[model samples]
Target chain A: MTLLNAIDPWLAGPRSAELLFPTLALPVLGLLLAPLLGARWARLLALASLVVGLVLALACTAALVAADAPLVYALGGWAAPLGVELRLDGPAALMLLLTAVLLLLIGLHAAGEFSVRAAGRRATLAFWTLLLGVWAGLDGLFLGRDLFNLYVAIEVLTFSAVPMVCLKGHAAQFQAAFQYLLFALLGSALYLLGAGLMLGVHGTLDIAQIRVALDAVATHPPDIGGDARAATLAAVALMSTGLLAKTALMPLHLWLPPAHGGAPAPASAVLSALVVKGSFFLLFRLWLDLVPDLPQLHVGLLLGGLGVFAILLGNLMALMQARLKLLVAYSTLAQIGYLFLLFPLASGASGGPAATAALIQVVSHALAKASLFLLAGRILVAFGHDRLPALDGFGRAMPATLLVILMAGLALVGLPPSGGYLVKSLYASAAADLGAWWWPPALELGGLLSAAYLARILSIALSPAPASGTGTGAAAGGGHILRAPITGLAAPALLAVCALLLGLLPPALFSVMDVARPGMGSATAVAGVMLSALTPSGFWRSAGPVLTVALVVVLFHSAGESAWGRRIASIGRGVAGFEGWLRQWRTAGALLLLFLLIQVWTSIG
Target chain B: MNEAQLYGVCGAGLVGIGLYGAILGRSTLRRLLAFNLVGSGVFLIFGAIARRGGLAGGAQSDPVPQALVITGLVVAFAATALAVALLIRLATVAHEAASAAATPGSTDDPSTPATASQGRGERGPGHVGAGHS
Candidate 1:
């Protein structure tokens, strides 16, 4: 009886075993039926899946609230190093809940998509399956404890995402998908190299085990042997740099604009909203857990530098885009830059629970960006093109969609009473308290740039003169063809309103942020001088500061004497040549071999 | 060499040969095939690495990497499926365009393109369905 008990732990007849909070089961429910249910069925099924997911995610939050620390679940009673774990800690749980909620919101907004059958039933099937896969993979990524398992989840994410780019199989879309695939492959390879290196020195692929191994190596110098230390640093760089590429950080972001630009509206929302966060989640995990002892000063400065570069380059790229979707894509790239800035702005001497302000910014950014993409997508569908000049009459044509987009754009631009503006204020106050003044300028610049690019649409929205308004009214063809299926558009607008509404109740949002407070709290009152008080007047005066920053950026990136693009042309190639070492024979082959050897050694050692 | 080493060596050779073909091959489809070969090499390398983890000191070679390889195999399949779908669509588009190009002064002829595609699209029996193909 004792021997049998050991072997069949979960096989108990009564199943007295405690049920987990049931996070994994939420997605598993959808996956079970995704193959059988046609796309039409998958829509309601996905909504139901997310609804269950949200309940479980909230339950997890409540559990955390009650437990006051992380709640770890071991599948089938397995513990961490031996068994895979799901840690429904504050941050991950909050993210999961947020992901579920936003997914449900976006899924609602993207309604009738699966029913269109425009690209045929197959396209519809692929879309729902991929969407479910994305949700599952992303959920898996955030919850997964093992590093190697996280890598597999991340790979699944990219595979599911790339096909969405060419769902309709247009020539341009194919090019975009191909580019996305190649870059994603390169990023994966780099991530694997770094992860493999860590495993090599540690002999374990577990996160906690690696952290301890790294800590021990730090104090004891066993795996910290001279060459291994360099390898470790190299690993950190490769991993972060790869993640930066995925995050579309500055120069490595050639693939993002086109990829996001080409995908269908709902798919674009998922891609822009959730997919990138999966990578950033890893970055947060690595910095917090594995490299906890990394010299904070250097790490902070390096991350801060990347953030600044992204801020400058993202806005500059956004400024140059003519197509509306591409413009939104560039704006997305810029928003991502602001996210990287959170590390520098929020971390440092104030690097405690007080840094909850920075974490709040992360949540804010996710919600806001998701809303923005959904808004852009709806506008595209309504107007039949996402070109800048083309959006002129959409406000009249798509009043509700336009109204939602404006609200989302307001949040994106950090306007008053919006989540983005409030999040930025918190981040700004934290930055100021940390004595990092330059970050304020960058934050202000990013906000202003968001306003500028967003204004391209708003300007068109508020345009006094009619823009030809050439197209027949929504119903020239037929009833269904005339008006957009309301569910797809309204759902995102509701999400946009929620993002705006969260700002009104900052205290509630802060409490949610409190759950994920893994770092030490400095106990500083991270609120700032009133944003309203920072101005001479109310809305118009606030616009002045943003407008001034906009002028500076325009002067900075503009052509002719002050042409930054022309000037950079001289140095860009040199930098590219230096960094393009993957083209070299020995370096490329040796790097690959080294990585393979590391993996082999880890399994053996 | 020995069995494990032989497998490892073969995987490495496959990766090298595949990389060579991708670089040299001008044809898009050939390059894609080479890419798949490289993937196979990586899988084989993984198989070789796991060999030591058997009941020997390696203790069945870490279920994590094995699981990773299997997931990777599935993902690779999806990517290949998408790639093939794009290729078939591309060939059709290209062939139609080329046919139009061959018959000069047929720019105004709408049927010129459809007729060219009818021959291929009409005889599309036994073609792989979207996902499976």
Candidate 2:
């Protein structure tokens, strides 16, 4: 028997082995079936797969809860060290469920947006097929137990996602897609190199096997030899740098805005909400599960520092955007920063709260950001453009869309009764527990900055139209009527509600994240923290700053002729200029290499 | 040094060159080639690692790294193909845009105006001459 088989027979048994295939296979099945079917039929097939996938994900979660252990399935009955394995733990299952829910809603929206009659048969067919490909890749990444397998999964994700960015076949989009592909290619290559080095040292590609070897090396450094340690350190550093590029963490994020903002709205929703998260999830796995012991304070602090930069710079950049879609994309860059904070907070005490906080942030941001993108799409359709300045009195045109977008903004700003609030609070407590004084204030500032940018959008949207009555509503926009289907509107609205209500999820549901990683603290403890902080005083303490900042931002934005406004505008322009410089290929590449070198130095030292 | 170590060093050299090309190459096609170079270097290292298994008294050459190299090659091939296809499409689109801009009154094409405006907005001033350069 293989070592894995001897260690855990249940992993090779039928019960656990049968669970993960459907989540993966269903999407792959849809992918295969999509090309063969007519456009409408293919869309139907894709939606059906997502629906079933969601149910399967839920069922898997239930099974995990019952078993209270991670489900591992050895492919073809060949256990690890010989064959690949798919694992479904709590986080994986949650990711799968999140993917399913968002894709289903986005698919519904896409059905309306890319109906054969509107977007052509071939385009419709291609969209469904590509969407399925992304789904399958995401599922694989979540389930993959082998590092190389995860690499392949990420490539699948990149390949599928790159084309989706330019689905409209626009020149600008093509360029964006090209840039995105190059970055991803570089990322995967580096990741592969690391995995290869890791295999050479540890003699296994399996994450569990590598972890075991690493632990052994930690205990008896001389036995494994210093060379082994150096190699392992280098591998971790290379892998992290590669994943950072893919995750678009701050300076490496040059490719994200254009690619995400350039895609069709539903496509943008998928790209923003799910695609980047796939790589981030893998990075999370690599750091927390595979090499939990290796990340010293400096490494953690470095990552968290980058997170802080991403949050501040991304929010500032978002405030300067003239286009609604680009604004949302920049907001995504900022929200992504919050995820990186987990690296630092996870270093102290139990990793459970920080991990839970990050996951909750992912879920909340995915829903809210997807909702915002969908709303942007609707706005673009209604107004014939998504130019922010021209979007005056938009709230009067589509109050429902405006309301939903506001709800989403509220969640993003970490206001009460929203998942963003829960995430911030969890992060605050985690940081406090760690005695990391700077992180809490950074989180607080991030929320205010998020509020400011959202206010920028809202203030313009809520402004009174000019006397020409040319910008009164959708009707005034060159005679194009807004025929947004109920499903199209409902999809984003429902997502917003879900994001808002996420904080109120049952305490038992929160505990689901603690499965497999019991050190993450119990769900009740996290929920109790949220509950105790849900009082009126607590709500204002959280919501007050956001509201005040948003009001100030709105007033500041409205008084554009004033000197202070111009000064702020110039500063915004300067930040934008700096951001543009950073997005250059050479600059970004240099930054990437510098970061890699720093990571290696930190790890080795 | 052993043959495996020599191969590993060569692989590392290739990776360095590839990274340099990928970072500094002006054209997308050149960058793509650089990416391939990196992929090849990584595979070579894997192969060298496989051969090193023999020195360690494992199998004559480990099958796992060999398998991994093969998988890596296939993935790199796929990525290269995709990048080339995208590059070709980009060329075609840029060519059309350039020609359309050259001739006035070609406004019949609905995509022309949008492309012309957006192409300027999304790209930096340096990249305005991208595909052609």
Candidate 3:
């Protein structure tokens, strides 16, 4: 028997093996059933699948916690080296639960967005199928323990997501979808190349087995003239470069703004909130579990450097955007930067503050970004455009949307009483522990930069209204913004509330994150540890400074432009050309190659 | 070099060529074709690895990588079809939009000038819907 089976034989049994059904099978089944049923029924079934999925995910988590070990299932009853294996560990469970919850909210919000009568039967059906398809891929991706299986999951995600981007059937949407497709294909190709090299080096494609083999190789250096080590380094670099491209990290982020900004609101939500996370989740597995010791410091620093660039460049681009959706999409690029910072802070396996902080950032950003996109959709319905200049007094026109959006904005700024604040504090303490003094300052400044853009939009939305409320109530299509149903506002409000309340959730809720923190079972103990980790000094050092900085930014934004402001604004505008150039395919490809070369050189040397 | 090494080098060459073409190609069709080329290269590398006997059973070649390659091929085919369809639709839409803009009066006889103006205002050029880029 394999070491994993010998250690935890019960996990290999059929006890919780059925959980994979709702995750891997049900979404594909829902998609297959979509064509036979009416569009409305298909949507109902899609939402039903999410509900079932969430329950199954929760059950799996409970089972894992109770068992105190990861649950592993060998597909077709054939163990790894012969068949695929599905592993449900702590982080996998958390990601599964996160995907299910967000898909449900996006599904509910999409039900109204893509009506059969309004958007046509075919479009509605396509949206529902793609939604279910994406869920299936994400569920499979999170649970998959085999490298090739994860690759297939990435392909499934890319296929479903590309179509969703072009659901509107617009020329620009098609162009964006096409661009997204090519870039994703490039990413998967590189990923597969790396997986193939690993398979060639080791006889198994299973993550656990590969980890054992890699550790052995590291411990006992084989006298093959260092070729094996070079190959392994190449594999790591190629795989990471591929996943980074798919995740839209900095220079590789060319296709993201166009695609996410071009897709329908619900599609954009799923793409931003979940799809990007799929690749990131795989990279997380690679860094933390598979090759944790190989070129650790250099690779982590390399990724962290890219994260810094993404933060500065993404936020600057967002600040320069004229349209609200593009602005939100750019903000997503910046938020992705925060997720990558975990590489440097959590490079060691101590599993302290940074890891949990990154997880909180992921969950908080998923909810807040989804809510913001939905709110942007409502604004579009109200004004027929989401141009910042034209959106003056929109808050007065749509009070409910504005309030929820403001809450989302607070979360985005990483302000206190929001999960963003929790993430900021956790990350700061972790950075200080690592003696990474520069990150804390960069993190605070990123919060301020993000605040600048959000405040700019909020100021416009809250500007003085025209003489009559009803005058602006009628959109160009005679669609009445005043007639927005309570149900219409319910989803965004729910998401916004969740984002805001994430910080307030019992530290025990973080028990899910403990899945990653193996051997740390006691919820109370975990909570206590997290509490001590969040000393008042840590909190004040990070969240307090960030909050104060954001407040100053908002106030300065409210006070209107000064000479200094104009100069900074001009600097931002100056970078606009660079941003536009980066979006071009040739430049992006050159950067990808450059990044791959750098990573390979550093890892090998 | 051995057979696996030879095939691997060729695969890498294909990938390099495909990436170069995909990046430099301005047209959508050319990029899609380049993507397919990259897929072929990746699959070729998988074949090379399989040929190196990277499986436990001591079979002639690994069946697992072959299985994975099949799936990858299927996914790539689907992607290609979708990309081609999108390119076609984009061309048609652009053509229709150009025609409409070129001779606005000839396309619609029933609508008054005011309705036409309103239609243009609602779904005008450069005014992407719902903030779509």
Candidate 4:
């Protein structure tokens, strides 16, 4: 059928069927060929699929933006209300294109790190196939208009993702993978329960139909049965809470660090960058698209509160980490916290600038986190360990990698001319506009916390090698230890550049984000507020937090290195203590039930 | 209450019990069983809905929910298989660690804190959080 369509110009022109190129066809083909393909060939095929997927995603984006409406394709030509539909709108296109680009870059990097000839044929094949599977799942998640179909996509994502965590076959890695699997299963079960409840009430699992039904029901005030209202609230709470666990939001994020930290570099990159976003994309669908005016202010606040905790606590944990990969994993947790700001910000102004800021945060974090993890992988390999203290003088050995890290760190710290900066400013302004007077400072504090953690790593990496002849490269005594592969360094460097340069792009680039967008009118006003932050005074106001964080890092470093040891260790213990308490299955379960109860109470009360 | 309503309540009760067991159980296998219990409960609710809703004359139950429940069962089976595989691997790993720890001279490479705590054979309930410690 694809071949036939390819030959027929009229049938082939910008059809919604093109969306499947990345989501289904590529993964299926990858799985089929994985057994026969060698490592090198598998890498090539991955690269090819990613490039083709990127082009297809761009085409869909262009077509959707040009049409200024969602592109909905009915499978077997059975329209919604009967058969499943695939949809590509502004947000879905953006996420799809982002996933393709990240996968392609990560694929290139993985080629260097996971050489088929070096890591055994089976390992290479498994890694590439799993990578492709994650891509396929993410693409489906972005485009899927049906809740049940999205659930299936998430399952594919989880099944593919869990193995990647235990690729090393280490005892610890196995534990992490097992924990990850259990958490995902628990989360998905809850999500399915919600979907089942929705189906029982609405009789259709299609989001579009549910939206229409809810709208029709909303028009009749007294006709709204209390039971239906409670059911909808329970359903929303169940669905989003399930997604929160998968997205690794705080209180539900205990499984993320170990699993993400244990994975191979490319796998970690894919897990951190794209896999988490899959659940988040669905949360977006539920909040912005499906139930925009649900009148669940308390739910929004609860989510925002969790986001705040994730940011602060995630950053604190990242700062406390002695190892590089764990540090990056915790940083991902914090960045996820930043993403949650959208819920509360969106609560105030419908279709406001907050959603756009959240979108920017998603894209920016995806690029930065992928770049950091890849670079961290390179550092891990070059130094033979990822311990923070062991990273001393590594900058001297691999200056290129250090530069990539620095650029990525700057993005993470929300410094100017980086997408993270734009995201922070936009979020701050959104909070200010919401009259939540407290949020702007919290936003600034998060940036400061981010700077403190990033600075901790950069400062350590920049310091001279320890006096003892213990550092990896410096003490090797060989005038020429093997250098990092060009392929490995190049990909992270390129991704870092992309993350750094993203903020410099024209505002017009964001126009595509408006299609099928939830709210209206307030967006332009919010955009104006965000653009004003680019002015000199606005820039200074925003830059103040970054400067303060820099001074704090410097002052902390100036205090005898011995002083930092005790203070940091105490902080570490406190953070770890709380985290340990939360990590217990019993506590996590209790919290999950508590959140559900609170959500149901808020909606009903 | 009608037959479907009774089934729905039964499903809800199963879910509550499963939730408690899954949360409280210490052993991995027990939790896995609890997860299956929850899945069963959810599937039962879906079955009940299908039976109650699809009474357009000749049908016994709605084919859609029936089909979905079947798919759900398949997914749940796959999940169970995966969990069991993990549990087997974990048991082997624990056994190996215990053996390695008993042999004193084998403690040369405490490459990570987690492995070190694992080597001590006293990883206890706090062992899981040692990776980043």
Candidate 5:
């Protein structure tokens, strides 16, 4: 290469400008305005940023569809691992578009709605900044071609999410938020440790370069009796475990319920809607860049199996929830389960049919879950309390919100005529294709459990308001008081309607979804689409038997500290001992002493 | 010790301690502080990582992590600020609810809000920050 070729990254490129300028604008604008203006204005600025972002994302998507192949922009005209590169491909562009649209809508709804004062202004500002930071982090992750750059993106995303947890100022939220923050930090530590090893072992942190480098590593006959491979696998395991903690995959999901559930409504919406996906997005990058071309499909299968467990556990817990927020939180865990299926499904070439089906499942789940969280937030806003029992007569009074909830819930349940069903069908069909017919049954069982719990919500929502009308917000003098909620209901309702609409038009989603290269599968893998679409609710009116079954299923799972079960017990202990604990802590001071010890440990260590 | 080695060991130690604190601490404020400690430790780790990146064949410390740490620091500050604000609000809510339930309509009592915001914002929040200690 000539000196001039090395002088600048790319030759006076307008194309680079297109990719760089629009993508960088949001964060730059955030930094510029965050400190200058009071938070109230900062929020509108954030929404404006996302609005611009949404338009840019759509335009980029349009460009990607029109022009095949990924759009690669080299920073400062440099190339490879040495020079930073911004890669925007079809799948990534689509992800960006999804994030932009969801976040823009979230900002729109939140700016007008969440009215905090002293801290509210500050919170609003932080929310906007974090929102932008999260978007940038995620967009960067998807496009990042290097290991080190991707690590930066992961950190940005993690820290951005931390504030959303404690934004509400609830005392309990502090602990919940702290727990999440701590876990996330540990995850980052592990990730860094892994990355450090990789860098030390391999000279370049560029993923493509690493992939090229791996050929030699892989072909080298067993080195040190495969100890080198052992080291690499150890790194991968550490990184995977760390990422799983952030995604709240299963047992590590201890922080999720509190972080997502305890947060205020808009915070909850963002936390559930996009934040979890950020780490999941990094996991996607890890798979694409770091892993061998022919990875062990069993790893993804293991994740999928755990995902199925999450679904069963999540729904059972959701079924048991009296508090509305916790139910939604559990639902989030279950929905996260659906996203995990993507790993197994995306390895379409290995198990061609299953992988192809996994594609459909991922797209559908993202949309449907985002819809569920937003709609649930709207429900909470509508009714002062989000307790299921408290919403006894809510359906009659707030028909529109109830309708949206039902539709979103239906999508969550994987009911027909909704995108969730199409996604489930593809996942199930894919499972069958692998002759892993057992997983299809597991998926169906998950579906049934989901339907049962969702039915619980719907039933409560559908029931007539009692003569007392006391618990539901109607007794609190409802009408104009919950205007923000009325607005909140609109977007999620639209999303739910679109959910069904998308199901009916799979050809269309499949078309745009075409941006992702067909790694290794035929389109026919979606055949279960019809079977799932045609499933009967004939079992619905036989509700008593099925309800009993759901109950038995739920009870069987609820015995110990199912992450959700433990949470409920803690809440109980918290309430029942609130005064006693307070008095005892004051009198005995043991709790205070424990807290002091903890402080000493942290500061000194 | 040089800053690099000192930071690495301190970072690891802080992470271990912070995780312990977060798991064991019952006090909400201590919990929040523990979280901050974890965050600081993570920053230290990132610093160490970036230092490693700098020592590579022909690379400066990765500007990306620098930028990212900038973002993370800001976000962490935001989180800490939110936590402080929330603690104040919780203090106010506790006082108000307790007073409302126990003393009934004693919200007019200035002492309730006093325990919440510092006694003197006129002296400024900077002063109040010091005053809290």
Candidate 6:
């Protein structure tokens, strides 16, 4: 009876219940229809489903806003601990809307790439089917209220994403895909083990029920026995470790760059921008909602410490990459690091600023990274290769694409009036409120590193073409012109602009971050923090990183002539060597176990 | 010891062995089989948990974990099938690359040499030794 009442607080009127079912169902329907219909019709069906999915997501957001509460729907009127439940809140709605918008635009771009007449019948059919499958999996992850159900959702996401990595069927791609599959399989296995442990201890798979049970155990430990706490902590530790591996946090990120870089452009865009976020969203939910009262401060610090390493090492690795796609892929490794900072920052009294900052960072990075990847695809098509050094004077050939890269780079570097700038300020303020003063300097250094790499690409791009009439030998000999479809360029251009303009959004709109967790961040607080960025002092703070980037670029340009340049080059090679050593299968696997052990020790201690 | 406790210990041992093999397996195929061992261990734990639930109260066994184990089994089976398919595809692709390298007239594919060099450059000699073995 108490368990029944425990669910009462979460039982809201299902105002948007109708909207939730279709968001998941529409994608499944499209995937199902793709095979029955031929290739051309399947592409149309896929696009149609995404458009409808977007509308459904918007309607869900509207319904949630109107009700001012999360919408929870029980499957077949059977309540939790028995039947499944789907919960829709502010964060989930925001992710739904973001996924819908990105997928639709990427779908439009994909329509041209995978057109029946161009990529052949089989590949076209496969791409559409896999895209919709990924959409359904992401939607499932966002809405699932049962921990076991969420595990299934993540598996769905992994299976669908792995095949897309090797769609080209090349040997290198096959190797990348194989490694990706192995890591993901290991992750899910551990996750399943943890879920089983939780079920054994809690007697329920529903997240709400487990939380209620945990609270009960906390209040009256004798009722459930002392071992329950240890079991619960161990279970949470295992689950978190599994999620970290799946999210590819720093040391666990060995599989990401190659898998993401080797995929087709549209696939890379989706993988980098959305697929990784599914596991991250689950991790956030586990820490914040499921085990908020547990002794996790040390765990948070461990994760934040890892974030620092990922930012420094990933950016350094990106700076050394000779291929445009791999550079962008390594940049993803760095951006993922920023997401982990939320754990430590939010662990303090004020979770509001950190939560809002992390949300903004996720949305903006998704947009910018997707745009950069699509643009990389455009460059590949125009030059017959994406080798960075050979891309000199590409700006002259594809001015619009270069412009898009600049906009995306601005967001990546967190320049003023961009989402990156807003996130950095919020992070600094959050760290200040927590009295953790070291984070602001780390964020600034990370921004500077990002700027150094972007400057490398832009400087090379803007350099003059050689005396011959060609920029790249491949482009010159192959006669590949710089003509790309308008949709290909326009789609990425729109996404990059959105990333830059994210900061300009009204502060009141960010109240969604506080939606189920009301004290997380208020509108006024967010407004004040955002407004501070526009101040003269804030403007100067933002300018400092830009100036440092300029200096780094100048140093790099004169590197061949100076002794300082040689020293910096040697350091770069050393970082690359360290990264190479870390990426070995045995090393990464050993690190996974070591991280799991550390996570367990922290949680239990 | 009680049956449930005994099974639980066995499950934990299986998990430890599976983790070791999955991490240090010499080939992708071995790793896939090791993953299956881990899945079996997890399922065994679930079964033991159900038995413990039965000893604690209402029914002969808790139906929920049983139901969960079934779903988990399906997922694991699907995962194995997919991994196997990918392994076969990888083998075929490697064979093709090796044969193409051996053949004299197969230089029509411009991407072959570039891919070969890129693989060597990216993995380094150390990785080639550890990864492909």
Give TM-scores for every candidate, taking all chains together and pairing residue i with residue i: 0.76, 0.94, 0.89, 0.92, 0.75, 0.94
lDDT of 6 at A244: 87
Q: State the lDDT at A187 in candidate 2.
A: 86
Whole-structure CA lDDT of model 6: 0.81
* Structure candidate 3, residue pairs in collision: none
For model 1, how does the per-residue alpha-carbon lDDT over A510-552 read when each residue is reduced to its tens digit?
A: 5543554544431223233233523557556556776665456
Q: Mind giving the per-residue lDDT tens digits that candidate 6 earns over B1-120?
A: 999899988998899899899888876777878889999999999999999988888668887898999999999999999977877777777777788889887654322112223222
Q: Which stretches of candidate 2 lie over 4 Å from their true place?
A: A1-16, A221-225, A294-297, A348-350, A469-481, B105-133
Q: Write the per-residue lDDT of candidate 3 for residues B4-104, one digit (tens) a residue.
A: 77988899899988998877765656667787888898889989888877433566788778888898888888888887777677777766767787974
Residue A568, candidate 1: C-alpha displacement in angstroms: 17
Mark the 10 consecutive residues where model 5 chain A has the least summed lDDT: A579-588
Model 6: per-residue lDDT, tens digit, A396-416? 777788989989988989887
Q: Per-model C-alpha lDDT, please?
A: 0.61, 0.83, 0.76, 0.76, 0.61, 0.81
User: TM-score: which is higher, 3 or 6?
Assistant: 6
Minimum summed lDDT over a 10-residue window in model 6 chain B is located at: B110-119
Error of 3 at A244 (Å): 0.9
True contacts kept of 3: 0.40
When only the first chain is scored, the TM-scores of the models are 0.81, 0.95, 0.91, 0.93, 0.81, 0.94
Residue A513 lDDT (model 2): 71
TM-score, prediction 2? 0.94
The top-ranked prediction according to TM-score is 2
lDDT of 2 at A191: 93
State the DockQ, from 0 to 1, for candidate 1: 0.11
The residue pairs found clashing in candidate 1 are A109-A488, A352-A520, A352-A521, A353-A520, A353-A521, A354-A521, B53-B60, B53-B61
